[model samples]
Target: MTTRKIVVSALVSALAGGTQLAQATDVFRLEGFGAISRGMGGTAVAHDVGPAGMMTNPATLSLMPDGDQAMIGLDLVTTDIKVTNKATGESVSSDTHSNNRGPYVAPEAAFTKRIGAWSLGVGAFAQGGLGTEYGNGSFLSRATGGLATGLDNSSRLLVLNIPFAASFQVNDKLTVGGSVDAMWQGLNLDLLLGADQVVSLIGANRATGSLVGVLAGIPGLSGAHFSLTKDKFLASGVDAWGYGGKLGMLYKATQDTTLGASYTLKSQMNDMEGGATLTAVTAGGQIPLTGKIKIQDFQMPSHLDLGISHRLTPQWTVAADVSRVFWKDVMKDIKVAFVADAGGDLNILLPQDYKDQTILSLGAAYALNDSLTLRGGLRFASQALRSSTLFAVIPATPRKHLSAGFTYAFSKQAKLDFAYSHAFKETMDNTSLPNTSAPIEVTHAQNNATLNFRYSF
Candidate 1:
């Protein structure tokens, strides 16, 4: 009945029960949204793809054929990850080969209506996320002085987005559009901090930031380490709501060429609140405490995209997009605070130090006949994460991608599209960190497919 009720209902129906583990290209953001865009190398801005435009460049919704349209899409993502923690001088080596939990599915839907010069649309989609799962036998279970807790190591994050968008055809050659976005995000993490990292956080938060006084008060506390683990009973995990907006412009520079640009603002979200099991280890013994955790100041970055679509011939079309993500602004650090029920509080800051990302996508489509079309594309991206700060739990580092797909029309009002993409494998050795003897090496690659069915009445 009311706006607050509407958002709450939407989140419950859309995100309450689902656990998504989708991979990303420009960090935690997907390379593309819809099947058509994925089939053509994540190109969408100027290409009249489909209602998924509500999540990309809403101005393109005006380019859809007249009348009402509805579409549903699904993406299946599979990721391969291998992590190796080796300390040559210390003779400690461990490797987790393909321990990621994946081959996950993401769903999307949209409806759009065109009335005269105005186009209105609404859509929901899985923006993107990252995850990994390592068993209890993994090296991550061991603490300082060879103490083993036998707890698994894992991390999962998912973001779902809803957009209400509108576009206006200002003139024969110009169109503009905007969308207000509602976003829901879920995060689950179980990380084991090494003795050195624990010491670093303690020093950084010494002035009452973390449980400094309590830690300092612990007698016989030497060689300290710890972990913040999610309770086994909490399935959905810590979550929060976020909001942002996007503005887009489309211009028909020529009969055969169209240009498009869009800007998305940074997201504003509250802290993620949830329960966690905090385990603190010391030379004396292991202290297990129950507490509430607040993940603070976690927000998505802003970005700008510019693209062009050109009809080279009656049977062929091509599109190219260049974009930049301002990660340096939002991904500086991740801060978390824990208040224990027993008698203490702890604060931790995880450094990200992500650089701005540059992405280039190029794609081409050709109509083979009246009912069939073929597409292929390539995407290139500059590395966004530095090896020194890259954590094994979140390895979003692929830099190149190749994709192909096809579309088939069953009738004037119905069609099916399918696309598949592969991210090239990459390996990073964390030799840049101070402890080069125990460099963490990660190898990651991905494959994903998108299927969409659309109908118009």
Candidate 2:
């Protein structure tokens, strides 16, 4: 069979499915790819940038400098978040808490080999993942030893994407390409509840409400519900896998102008299967129980990108792109089934109701000379998640980004690329249930930096 046939079959079987890491907490969509792309405010669609461009638009491969090129890079992200707690009638702040999950690193690598008009490449990288760690026994779990005695209140999600890509020049003016990715994700979450929180959840959480309502009529049995929920040890961890494909086209509209478009299919993943350990504090110390938790109806969002780049002169060029993410289809809600060791089975549905989002990126680059080039860009993304549904585990809502960077050559075949971006602080209020509990006010801000090295032969 031909390469096209094999690729089609593999993508159908692999890319159709995808994972369960928590929602990304950074500035949406993995914060613009990397240094080369990030330096231009994530504008890889029309202006090619070696291996970094492979994940954004595979067709750009045909337009790359003719040679075997390899690249390795990392994006270091620092996120600052604060949550306003309202467990009581009054409000108190949780004192600014930075993510306890340290070394927040995103790494990537890619290699390309060109033969005539054909460009073949392979890449491995983290597509996107948002993770955070607040001490497990703190905040909401104050009754159970609060901040000092227990595990941290935290959650994590990681999505790994590997694409095998190929691009071909259709003629002197156009190029097309596609790639299939084997995507997998991992998730871990830990949350504790106090008496007030338990009361609030019993009323707002459909699963807990239904389970507790059964004992309402029985005078002696009703109190048992509160005991089970009070200082409740609630946490779970799981892993999932799936597949997806990306298609792209690049056209040379004029001698100095290039146009590009690309689409990424949503990945369908298997149900998240894992175990949760439940424990409660008693006079005899801590009583523990373990059971299974299955999460279903979860998938990653799909997005479309279009771009245009124009070279104003031999040393200067400008580019712009628009991308839209269909988050509603995949992030509407999460359904989970709890198989317990003793206290009856319960099924819970967590509401997300995420909306679609559009992002605009504009950038320009000027070559200072043969060994150095400078670039800067701006990007804005409309909020996709409603403030009411925004949870602490997923605090990635930011509106504007300012970026600047440069590329310097140390030798003929070796070079370094670096970018820096700062997302203005944004505060999303009432990021919790509207009337049931005190509105959870969440504030987020970030400092993002990336560094990369390229070697061509």
Candidate 3:
């Protein structure tokens, strides 16, 4: 293989591995593209850039310098996630903080070449990922009388995407660009079986299903006999691949204003291999359960974006963007196909009635001197999913973000960029399917920093 191809492959691999250690943020998307865009609230569609523009809007590739340009960026992210279950009969309520994830860094890299009025680029970046782990003792059994008090629950997910793109300068007035991305995703979930569901499946009096075994002496059962329908830790994980693409256009409306628009199609991935396994411990013994997600239509959502950039003065530039994501179809429910079951299929209707969400971004940059530029911006979005569907593993519910950054050009060919962003604390309330006295509450917050090095030929 060529040296360029080798470097590209290595970089993509690195991004995939790094996200395994970071927590979920901004729902499932990063707030911005790179140091430059992050500093200015991730509004890069109408701005000028080289490799960073590949993920934001391929059309911006045409806005780059005439020569070749390359960039590498690193993002350091830290998260605070907490889940609180309300107190109920025989079971004591709990407030647990999930801190197992974070202090992680994700990377992005790209190379762009400009020839005549056309530009070609290839890049890799970590889209988003989340991880959560709750202590075993955090949950108590009011029914089991505390015998099953130890709970092992957690989840992790990551997406690493690679895009090949090209842009054309149709005229001084417009530029168009397009790209197709190969999307790869990994998912891991370790969750406790629902108390109510367990009751329905195994309770001695419920004659609906045949009982293979029962937790005979467990006091938490509240004087009822029950069997294990699911495992204590359901570790269902899979790595899968999919495809998607984007189309964009940049318009020079006037000497001072630039307008941009783009649309991205959804990505569809195959079923997760090795499915998931469930382990149940009982007086009768431990029974193993297994299943795979019925990925009839597992895919990432599609979105549309519109942006504007205006030059107010020789030293000041301002930009704003509005984006909408359609999540209703892809996120409403999850189905699991067990190896064999009398109930036919195990289908869990998720509370994730994720609606079509709208996000707004605004930012400005000032050229302070020959070598320094200062930037700051804000990003805002409403709720993506309803409180009833909120879960501890994926807390993508923050509503506001603040950021600031600067760039230092050491020479004509080299530059260093930095930006820091913070998503304020937000709380989400959820309803558990069975046995909840009150809504379960989840709180989330985040801090992110970006650094990048770029060179121009």
Candidate 4:
């Protein structure tokens, strides 16, 4: 293979290995794209952040200097997550339990070349994910009175994107660009559901057919609990591949001001299939069955962003963005089916009832000197999922964020960029599922850092 091909292959492998686990800020999506963008509050639609823009606004690639540029970056994420199941019952009431999964790490790489009016690039990025883990001894498992022992409560969702993008400078003031992304995603789950909750979901969605009848007729099943577990980590779990794309435009409205916009299409993915164990806790005993599991219709949501950036002075620049994500259309329900080896089949539905989300970002960057730059930003977002339906496995409840970072140039061709961000703690009472007298309280908070090494010729 040629040198360029080899580099691309290595970068792809690195990205695949790096997206094993991630805790995001904007529900399942990350708060930022690159170090520079993260420092200034996850703003990328109007500002230029090199090849990383392919994952944000591909048209921004046109703003780079006319040369070859490459970047390798890593994101270090730390999460503070705790789940509390407060019940008034006698056998299942318990205290708070913590998720000991992270700090996590995700790697990314991109190469872009600008020639005349056309800019082209290829890049790999860990778009985002959600994860949480609790031991079997916790209240979630003990709620089953040892009927669900060894069945820990956990879940993980990982997504990665590889985009081949191209941008054209339509005129002196307008640039248009787009990218075709190859998407890959994986899921790991170890969830235990009460019999009452399962029955409730089936009624809520009006699920029908012979399979549903068979499940309802099973003896001693009404008072039982169900556990769906795939014995794997987030890295090597049941996975699927899909395709999606984004369209973007940049308009140089004036000498120092620019307007930008982008829209991402929802992913088209196949069902994720893999081996799993299904355990049923009943009055008679615990029934563990070996089976193959299928996660059906799990797809990411689509979103649109509008933004503007302007240079206040020779050394200061400011940007703002408004975004809307169509979550309700995609996250309403997720179905899982299990076909046992010995006999029997079962199906269940996970209801999200998520609403569309709106986000606002504001950031500023200052060139302190020729060799150094400073950045800061703030982000506010509306709720995506209803708190009453929240669970430990998916606590997507971050509403506000603060971020800061800097870029230090060592020479003309090399620079190091770093950024830090914090998602404040959010706690909510979930009284919807896992049917108990009292509500389940979920608290989540996070901190993140991005470091990148950039080189250009």
The local distance difference test score of each candidate is 0.77, 0.67, 0.68, 0.78
lDDT (Cα, tens digit) per residue for candidate 3, span 1-457: 9644554555556544444334445567777877999899888889875487878789999988888777777888877767766544222221233433346567778788999999998877777676565545654222233345244555656666788999999999999999999887766655554445355433523222222233333433332211111222212256678888999999999999999998888877775544554444443334445444443355777888899999999999999999888877677754333332322233333335678789899999999998999999999987787776566556778879899999999987778899998899898776654322234677788788989877777
Decoy 3 TM-score against native: 0.83
Q: How many clashing residue pairs appear in each of the predictions shown? A: 0, 17, 12, 0
lDDT of 1 at 346: 73
lDDT of 4 by residue, 115-140 (tens): 88999998888888877766566666
Candidate with best lDDT: 4
Mind giving the per-residue lDDT tens digits that candidate 2 earns over 115-161? 99899988766677765555434443343223222533455666777
Q: Pick the candidate with the highest TM-score.
A: 4
TM-score per candidate: 0.90, 0.82, 0.83, 0.91
Distance from true position, residue 63, model 4, in Å?
Answer: 0.8
Off by over 4 Å in 2: 1-28, 86-100, 136-138, 143-151, 193-205, 208-236, 279-287, 341-344, 431-436
Query: Which portions of model 4 show Cα errors greater than 4 Å?
Result: 1-18, 88-100, 144-148, 205-234, 434-438
**lDDT of model 3 at position 184:** 75
If ranked by lDDT, best first, what sequence of candidates would result? Answer: 4, 1, 3, 2
Say which prediction, candidate 3 or candidate 4, comes out ahead on TM-score: 4
